[model samples]
Target chain A: METTPENTAHGYIRAGDKEKLRHRLRRIEGQVRGIQRMLDEDAYCIDILTQLGSIVAATEKVGLLILKDHMDHCVRHAVERRDEADEKIEEVVSAVERFLRV
Target chain B: METTPENTAHGYIRAGDKEKLRHRLRRIEGQVRGIQRMLDEDAYCIDILTQLGSIVAATEKVGLLILKDHMDHCVRHAVERRDEADEKIEEVVSAVERFLRV
Candidate 1:
């Protein structure tokens, strides 16, 4: 595991994952800036709420990506380490619930 | 971008961050298992609520670590790229709100 790349987008980020995350985050970024401009321009409350919801959804996607990576790497490694892996799994399960509930 | 070491704990994880994160997660993992046992033993409602609160706090700590990484890497990089970095900052701001609100 000492051969991981640094910044090739494939190094720390999973293959193809960086592109997807970047694309989504870029969009979210735009939506957020738009919201700020809207607020500056005094847009309606419902409009702002709608934008907030979209931002929330986008943020959730980011959380999911990280969650997937954690499961694939951290949790899986723990499972191979020993029988105590169940505890790790439970932590992840509870985390997912919190993520989704938000 | 291409020099990140793989699995050295320093590859993706910040020098000291992994140790801290792992330690915290280990403790949280134990707490979670204890919660399961408490539930199994039919612990009182307030007891369960307190455990849930602790779990939530632990989760928030994890989230904060990730947020720090994102700001130090992703947001800072975006800022160097151009003025559009403000939007990225806003996205992170909103995400923090969502994180804390939960």
Candidate 2:
């Protein structure tokens, strides 16, 4: 039902996970801002770096969740259709590679 | 010269690099908040996931910068001091493992 991306082939987040993802993102956003504030206040490099580790880990976790949902729903659907199975598999592989590279 | 972190031996960000790190962090903060806002407005999952990738990469990049600075200053200084060389090496190795794990 989403129209903003101009297509129905994307944005396939599961309904239940959407709210959970939103909450996580909001918290991550706050943590990012908090780091900036720490910098502005001249926080320690070690502390800031430590905090940054947490952010990266959190963001990575969120990505994993979305990736799982994609596989569970969208990817599963595509596999069932067989029409876009290769494309979907390739896409998910690429996504996993990106996450791994980080 | 920072007093809050207490007793020094940390917060060793180089003077020249502090502002740069701060600026990068500020932009990253905005990007994070933007993702949250996107969700609040029903942004697509694929789109959000893509955006999340960027955040993870950017945050990782910032962490690398801080790590480099830490090595160049703090770790290097420790290496010069025979007393703390092993400790600093272990500390840096631990940090690297953490970043790599993420």
Candidate 3:
């Protein structure tokens, strides 16, 4: 189709979900810009490392939020479809491993 | 609602996309299991290192596939919806940074 459906039969987003996600991201954006300024000024190595760690933690939190949504929406939908449930689960597990590869 | 719905109004997956994704994930699963075997028997450091690299690369490929899908579907959908598009872009970029942290 030339245009995405107004709402796919399978869409997952809710009105509130979008708003909440946006707010969280805005905060993260500020954190990231701060990191850039630190880098530009050649901030102390340990200080930079601390900020880096915070960024990583913040990013991981976002990933976890997305993953939770996936479980609630995508995975739940797939399981109800009566096909590929195990495979779908395995896919999520694979994703978690990739996410935790640090 | 307790139900995830027959399809969300925002569903991104198409029939062909599902099949292709499953096949790719299955292969990645096998590779992961193989890595476990290598670890189980105390394989040579170099040999293990090689497989670990392969796993990271394979996982990154999966992430790339996902990002492509997001850009094609989720990002496009968000843009058309006239919502927090910039925030969403920054969110994705933050995700990329976390993914490349290694």
Candidate 4:
């Protein structure tokens, strides 16, 4: 489906939150570059792996943040709408399950 | 940053692939809802966990697909551009590292 502005407006992510999400993604991008530079300089594998661990942690943080936003906004809105409350609840529950699995 | 059509056009996910990705997400949404119904019916914990594991696997597939698309399109484009090739390469490597961590 086409992602119109109106669609986005009614979706889970708030405008401000989306901006923050993008900022976080950009930072992650930078971190990745830093790791590459380290590799080029023949950095120790353990040190590189440590940085890799940090990146994984940071990425998970971003994912969790988005998941929380989805629950707070998308799932909540679905509950309020009553049109697809069951479906919405299930979606959120499913997301929570997946999140916890990590 | 604002997700303009132009920006998307130049980015990783191709138009056809985006449609497929959305379809997969919708399926995941359905699976999640199904799990909730199972929970309400007092399903076994192991069964529930099994379903949750499926969701995780499916989610990981989606993430991997997107990551591959990023490497093929965005990273490749960046490399061809030669302007920020190092940064782009690193970004992809970081993503791969995170994916493998799971």
Candidate 5:
């Protein structure tokens, strides 16, 4: 939302992406609640496990979306400006490692 | 709640653990909603990712708890009864692989 390198480095996602991300998160919350309902209803454990995997995968997709946005906008801007590009790249790499479970 | 080898393989979790698992899941739902609010407030992306990481970690913990319960009750019961022990073990291994992201 801000138009400065400092805000970019400080790390907020693009404003346009915010509502979409929030929407995904709301769905994820519903999924979690669904799993709880499954448990209460005595649903099969394997079915619940499958649901859990999907939830995790969905969450990672949201994360990847955010991470991708950063690369597309913030990091790219930093590189174009030649301003703190190294720090930006390093921060993103660390985030990638965390997401990858490395 | 029901007892018989068929019900076990069909995969309902143990009665006692259901409440606890549901409690954990409720907490996770809250966490996911918390992240949504964070986005709405324009929190830092790294902070959001960190929050995402914790949500994944907590969800996996719930999956693990269910898996462990299956191992302790269903699988062990199968082995002790010599009733489809191989199938139970195979099912659990598959679940473990899914959980471990293999």
Candidate 6:
């Protein structure tokens, strides 16, 4: 049987997912560094702000994607098991609320 | 004086920020579509999961970046105005709490 998100006690992501996540984070880290360099160089305030906005949007997209995955995998698994599907769904709702606040 | 985030009635992002955010979101949207395509192709489950994880992390990073910007710009501006710095700070705290939940 395939390992689901709920299979792990801590809800650990699969190895492949973990690797991809690390790579994306590294790239984002670089982007952040670039923004800092621009600031140091006294780049135009508007330009700096623009880059910051990009970073923010990119980050939000990432979060939403993960949330979707969690719902698809973890939540689905929960339903299959006839376990705490409602709780899992509530957790997702809370997560969505948090995502929007950001 | 430069227009700060708080300057707008809706706390509107600057023009440059808005443009960059739109662009970043477009890229992320493409990435999401790619993931869906992979799913349709019956790509390796692990591979799909990995991509999903990357998307999640990227989204979280974007949220954090935006939160930081809000603190540095909007919150700071609020402090200067001596209007609602405390409220702004509390809002940030709540936002952080939400971010970590993801």
Per-residue accuracy of model 4 over A18-74 as CA lDDT, tens digit each: 567557656655655664454344343334445545555555665566666666866
- Which of the numbered candidates is closest to the native, going by highest TM-score? 5
State candidate 2's TM-score.
0.81
When sorted by DockQ, best at the front, the candidate numbers are: 2, 5, 6, 3, 4, 1
Clash pairs, candidate 2, are A11-B45, A44-B11, A45-B11
Q: Which of the CAPRI classes, incorrect, acceptable, medium or high, describes model 1? A: incorrect
RMSD to the hidden true structure, all candidates? 19.3, 3.7, 12.6, 15.3, 4.3, 11.9
Candidate 3 Cα errors over 4 Å, as ranges:
A1-9, B1-102
Report the C-alpha lDDT of model 1 over A1-102, residue by residue, as the tens digit: 121222122233354764675566556556645644543443432334445555555555555665676567556767998755997688777766654454
Worst 10 residues of 1 chain A by lDDT: A1-10
Candidate 4, which segments miss by more than 4 Å at Cα?
A: A1-102, B1-9
C-alpha lDDT of all candidate models, in order: 0.53, 0.76, 0.66, 0.56, 0.79, 0.56
Query: Model 6 Cα displacement at A41 (Å)?
Result: 31
TM-score of each: 0.41, 0.81, 0.45, 0.47, 0.83, 0.46
Give the per-residue lDDT of model 1 (tens digit) for B7-96: 122233354764675566566556645644543443432333345455545545655665676577557767998856987678777776
Total backbone clashes of candidate 5, pairs 3 or more residues apart or in separate chains: 0
Cα lDDT of model 3 overall?
0.66
Worst 10 residues of 2 chain A by lDDT: A1-10
lDDT of 2 by residue, A49-87 (tens): 778888988998888887787788777988998867997
Fraction of true inter-chain Cα contacts (below 8 Å) kept per model? 0.00, 0.47, 0.00, 0.02, 0.47, 0.02
What is the per-residue lDDT of model 5 for residues A1-102, given as tens digits with 9 covering 90 to 100? 122445544446766688788888989999999998777666767668878988898898899888888788778988999998998899888877786777
Grade the docking of candidate 5.
acceptable
The model with the greatest DockQ is 2
The two-chain DockQ for each candidate, comma-separated, is 0.02, 0.44, 0.04, 0.03, 0.42, 0.06
Off-target runs (Cα >4 Å) in candidate 1 are: A1-102, B1-13
